[model samples]
Target: MSDEKVKIDVPEVPSVLPPAEQKKWVETYKAAFEEAQNDDPGDVVKQRQSALREANRLLRVEKITSADQAKALPKWKLVQCEEKDGVLKVVTIDGKKYSFGVGRGAKQQAPAGQGGGQNGAGQQGGGASTPPPAA
Candidate 1:
């Protein structure tokens, strides 16, 4: 074979946002991901807090990098972070913003078959119970 290298042509994928904006968001995501993975330790309380922060960061990463959210990344204008809560909330291009907490965007899963949607009307055993067997 000759010393000349083979050239491969790669097609550019179309994006809703301009390349510069996409690059900015991609860099932001990379920074956030790297920040979450840093595990430098401090005092006991700080260490615990760090662990919790790491966990929340990982959860946020999973949420944002998911298939559906990944597609929307180019449209994200801002990433709002709550350091106390350790949550990173994304603001979309159309100005929709949401914070993390109970019932914000995070969902609390009910135990399997528990039907946790009831409004505390003493609805336990809400399913029809079988009548007592004839004596």
Candidate 2:
């Protein structure tokens, strides 16, 4: 018998974003997708506003996080937060960056559940994924 057991080094899977965030991401991305399809910035902006309003509204509706906290402006939660031209450069939990006009990331989701993609599969692709990047 082999004295040493086989050491299975399982590859870590990525984490998925939260449902609330996923909902917001889907809404915004879908709107932008439609806008991109139409090639209308006006429509894009309009839909973008709509999405933002809805996102904020959802956050407000849920009351999970404060709608008015100095550091909690309730913008999209990103992998990284950047600032430019008084706008926020938020990288979606999936690493996609977008320009949010102004506000802190109102993401109340635990870091683990902040960026799950389609079908709630999350970044891990399933339950067998690795941890997400460090905050």
Candidate 3:
């Protein structure tokens, strides 16, 4: 017998959430978003947008896993976050809405060895700035 593995290719659907579930999740996100807006009531349009993105991402991962369709790269994104003027903003490919992780805590630290001495963003790992930090 040959020891060969069969490969299965699953189509990447825009959304893993079922139609009904998608609506429900969207509604939930909207509610959370409204609550945040009310609490802050400041000029944090971008931050709110980012929060919405992260929330939705988490929700999608939960839904997909529940549906037993979570593959290698569950498409989970911590949700790109940006902080400006004490307010945090988040965004994704398309205009999605979510409301979570707004002004939670300290900024995120890159997992060591991820961004070596490339892109002029400093060396990888130890967050070292290249060019030898102007001796």
- Please provide TM-scores, in order, for all candidate models, with all chains considered together: 0.21, 0.22, 0.30
Positional deviation of residue 52's Cα in model 1 after best superposition, in angstroms: 18
Q: Please give, for residues 48-99, the per-residue lDDT of candidate 2 as tens digits.
A: 4544444444333122222223125344343555544444444444343333
User: Which pairs clash inside model 1?
Assistant: none
Q: Per-residue lDDT for 1-135 in model 3, tens only?
A: 333322222123336455664666566556655655555555356435644664466453222121112122223332434444433333233323221222444232222122342121122345453434454
TM-score of 3: 0.30
Q: Is candidate 2 or candidate 3 better by TM-score?
A: 3
- The candidate scoring highest on lDDT is 2
Which lDDT value does model 3 have at 73?
A: 23
Find the 10 residues in a row with the least total lDDT in model 2: 5-14
Better of 1 and 3 by lDDT: 3
Order of models, best lDDT first: 2, 3, 1
Clash counts for the predictions, in order? 0, 16, 8
Indicate the TM-score of model 2.
Answer: 0.22
